[model samples]
Target: MTVRVGLTGGIASGKSSVSSILAELGAVVIDADALAREVVAKGTPGLDAVVAEFGDDVLGPDGELDRPAMGALVFADPGARRRLEAIIHPLVHRRSAELEAEAAPDAVVVHDIPLLAEVGRAGSFDAVVVVDAPVEVQVDRMERERGWSRAEAEARIAAQASRADRLALATYVVDNTGTLDDLRRRVTEVHAELAARA
Candidate 1:
């Protein structure tokens, strides 16, 4: 009877911020990004597969995955990106499922998945909550808050599934174009709705 809610948003759209608020309201937040990192940590099976496919150069001097170096290799190469996803996606999903199973039956479990739209996982959740903001707002946040150059911000935003597509899958949409207080209010409202549903 747990409510498996998928929470997603575009880059810098305050998705993680909303997820934090949801967690504060007693939802069990299982982060896909965090799980992805864990499954590929220095000695995991995931890292072994990555090393076999991308070579040892992708590893840092301390033997951890050199994330920047790996990003450089895969970001520009579609085949390389697919290979990496092939290795990591299943591992991430399996770990997420295990975590979800540990939640209380009546818990409102929120899975923070950045690529929910692109990965076609919306239907797997009881409800999809989209933390949305105008693309221009996201671009500004990237530049001012994250110190990204305009070009870099635009490129990163373009890399994700489109905002339209993300919203299309949203059972609840929290627009995050304003202040932190405004965003939190929206998240609290959504959390209440989710809790009731659970």
Candidate 2:
């Protein structure tokens, strides 16, 4: 039995850190963001599909997808965002399935999905682990680490599912407001539970 865990959290809330720890603990981690980029890389059909839907101007001089340029268009327009998802989501799913298939039986497989709640997909996993921090903690990290302006950080946070919503589906919640050692301890505890389940 493979224990499929979906790990998600607000932007800058430390999902990546937890995912890294889980990987180090022998979980087969499938990263959605990495696969999203891979699907849209210079030579893939995902990039070509984007060019077909949005036109060549979304590409940079070197012919790669100019992400920020395209982000500007999609983030500001709901229809455009959906169209882009229509192109990329299936490809991401297919690749993710392939990676999940490669994991051993009884291995704990974690899907690091930033938008699991926003996409209403928390129930698909055998368990969901939410890396939680207070909104202020999230905003502070976004500003201090990612250098996002206060408004930008707030906007990004607001765009996701509410904390209550995420927690409602969580099998494990790693509160990340404290020190690194504290967070690591919580992660290890959760990892042990997931491994036991497997």
Candidate 3:
């Protein structure tokens, strides 16, 4: 049987790092963020829908989605963000299902979904792994890694489900407040447990 795992965390919470380690440990990783981009690529219907909803300003000169432009609009307005999600989520879900179907029967399928909690998809998976970090750590990491100002980072963080919410959905919680080595060890333990289940 395939063990379907939902892996999620807030921005700058080291979810990506945990996903990478899970992939290295032999899970078939399906990344939702990557699918989100693919669904809205320049020539796709997803992009067309976005353009229709948000106007042409959300597109760059080259005709692709201007992410920063879109981000600024949606993050400031909850309704706008919901409108965008309405267009993108279905496409990503269909694509994710297709990818999961293609995995081997006994594979440990890890779906790396940054918005799993916000999207309310925890119950769809056999297990949920949440990479958790404090809000202060997330703010600091965003500033150091993504060059975002304090307010910018906070805005992004505020847009997602809270740390407590994500934790409540987790079957396996990987605490990410420490060193890289610590994260790896914690993820390894989680991966081993999932692998045993598979």
Tens digit of per-residue lDDT, candidate 1, span 75-163: 88879999999999999999999999999999999999999999998999999999999999999999999899999999989889999
* TM-score of every prediction relative to native: 0.98, 0.98, 0.96
Give stretches of model 3 more than 4 Å off. Answer: none
The local distance difference test score of each candidate is 0.93, 0.93, 0.94
Number of the predicted model whose lDDT against the real structure is largest: 3
Error of 3 at 149 (Å): 1.9
* Candidate 3 residue-wise lDDT, 60-165, digit = tens: 9999999989988997888999999999999999999999999999899999999999888899999999999999999999999989899999988987889999
When summed lDDT is taken over every stretch of 10 residues in candidate 3, the lowest stretch is 152-161
The deviation in Å at residue 82 for candidate 2 is 0.9
Task: Write down the TM-score for model 2.
Answer: 0.98
What residue pairs clash in candidate 2, if any at all? Answer: none
